[model samples]
Target: MPEPIELHHQGVERSIGCYLLDTDDGPALFDCGPSTTIAALKVGLAAEGLRLVDIRHLLLSHIHLDHAGAAGALVREHPALQVHVSEIGAPHLVDPSRLERSARRLYGDSFDTLWGELTPVPEANVHVVGDVVVGLACFPTPGHATHHVSYLDDDGTLYAGDAAGVRIQPGRYVMPPTPPPDFDLEAWQRTIDEMDRRAPERLALIHFGVADDPQRHLADLRLELFDWAEFVQGGASEEEFIAYGRAELADAGEDVAVYDVAMPLWQSYRGLARWAETR
Candidate 1:
């Protein structure tokens, strides 16, 4: 049997999407969480019977801190590490100024606390994924972040960042992470179509664990997004819309997840303001 891929989730809330994927060449890490959560991730990794230095590769789904926040610090810690990210996002990884500026607006002073200091991923070590069959692949899944890209493992599993939307559980509902500036509805749908085209048997969402039913979950996600779009396109005030979204959450009534778009998740909209703007 192929060596089972080990997947562990850490720093979900702090925007740190930490995962360890076991491969034949050795073990690989998906995204390392923020600096603070690095310890937590290390602990989690150890629990799986591994350590930080054991990780041979670090693959990122996108450039957003929550997803790739600790990449620089990680590279700092393990000097020989190789980092892979989307071409669109690779430059920002090497020079996080633009990434930092945008995040500062959304996070203010707490950006450091939530994501740790984003250091630059050395350009020499960065690869702008241009070919697939060569191994790991980057699938453009914009709208969440114009620079966003997700990873596809040869096993037919997708490490989909915000491209597939956010859900608290596998067999659960989805809500857009709609945080500000670059959420394009048009791009998002096309990305989803592309995702379905790949026919991934499993999905690893940054917010939570692996999902087995991609089609069902995607269907649910589309409905919720439309619900939000209709609320916006139909002329509902922000207050009414937020309240309405909450009410809709109440209606879903499964393993519940309700984020106050008005209240935010971290410091800015907490993730709500951007979501509202996207809507």
Candidate 2:
């Protein structure tokens, strides 16, 4: 089992995390949280008795800042580090101007504080993933984002970014992180099918912790994703949708604030609304 190193985004616990595992080649990180949390990330790494340079590879699930924002910074410090991402996400990592602009527009004033710097990864350091990366089986797991992908370890641990949804461990409620610009219900359903087919023994989620039950967790995520999509399609207001999400979390005995920080309900609503509009 791969234990996650909590980055503690915005001082919130279990809101964002990354995993460090031994790959066939060497030590690799499943995801590196945003630059704002880099100090905390280093602290976590030091606790594990490994320095940044000791990590040879960074296996990114997507170009999303929260998942891979520290790519360039890490590479800059340790020139030997290699970053592996989907082909669709490769260009963005090399030149993050467009991605930064999009994210700035969405985040506005809080952009810097929330995500810190968006540095471009040197072209040489970026490796587009194929069927296999390091030692894990790499496969497209789009839905959370068009460029999203997941890595399956030999031990059946899926490095499921946001594709498997957000479920703060110890809390059973699974919330789909359907962020805008690429939230497709049909596509995500297919992704769910694909994940089920893979049959991972455990899911390594970036939002929080590792889930031991892949089947049940994925099933719950599928149902909640459809339910949220339908709710948005039916014209549920953002406030209503947020309340609905909070109610679910509250009922599950989970800390609403922690889950909110991990995956904002408003963003999910906007994504669902956009998808609904297309329909």
Candidate 3:
């Protein structure tokens, strides 16, 4: 297969990216980015002489909006598209009422604007990752979210959704996206070790592009995950947390818009703080 194509979302330069893979069967999409960027995704695909209909497989790393919000839209457009996600997240996609309400509570008035229309994916089309996909293997890589999973192919390429953390650019510092409700530090550390054991040749991140150095990347990410959590544990105020996170992202060379839209600084800090408190 050719090099994976990166479909950059319009709002955030490198914050959210959906990758398209050319498989022996047909075109497969790794993550759908968000429902707001559905039009841009179509444009991106068209640039490569393709369209939404050409995508036969939809492998989601998780069911987070940034990763799988466009899934319902895509499946609705192409009824034949088979969506492969973690078993835990499959039901949420099928009946998104609770999910939608929870998201609205989090995002408030910005929910519709940021995420757009989030329709329910038919239960018939949704299948657990390992249960359906022929050759691809889905490993339960939680920590980022309870419903998170990473896809591993025969060539040692791992489509490590958020379980691998977010790397906006190569050579830039890796940032931990410890968002609320399910950011377990222990689980995340274990997941990191598991990823290292797998020794993937390349890690395709949903946040941005690919990272070739698995060893160094995982090590840096692991250390930062702990370091960030420690920082949050120091009893910093919400403002302090946001300021610190903003500076770190800026120092890493990410744009202001990318930081604002993708970082979710306060929410991430809250997640880490909650994890630390509960632990």
Worst ten-residue run, lDDT, model 3? 1-10
lDDT of 3 by residue, 224-255 (tens): 98888888888887788888877877787766
What are the models' TM-scores?
A: 0.83, 0.99, 0.93
The alpha-carbon deviation from the true structure for residue 152 of candidate 1, after best TM-score superposition, in angstroms, is: 2.3
List clash counts for every candidate, in order: 8, 0, 0
Report the lDDT tens digits of candidate 1 across residue range 179-273. 66676667777888888888888888766557788898777776666666555666666567656656655776633322331123232122334
Off by over 4 Å in 1: 1-16, 254-279
Evaluated against the true structure, the overall lDDT of model 1 is: 0.67
Q: Predict model 2's lDDT versus the native.
A: 0.92
lDDT of each: 0.67, 0.92, 0.81
Identify the superior model by lDDT, candidate 2 or candidate 3. 2
**Model with the higher lDDT, candidate 1 or 3:** 3
- Model 2 lDDT per residue over 52-168, tens place: 999999999999899999999989889999999999999999999999999998889999999999889999999999999998999999889989999999999999999999988
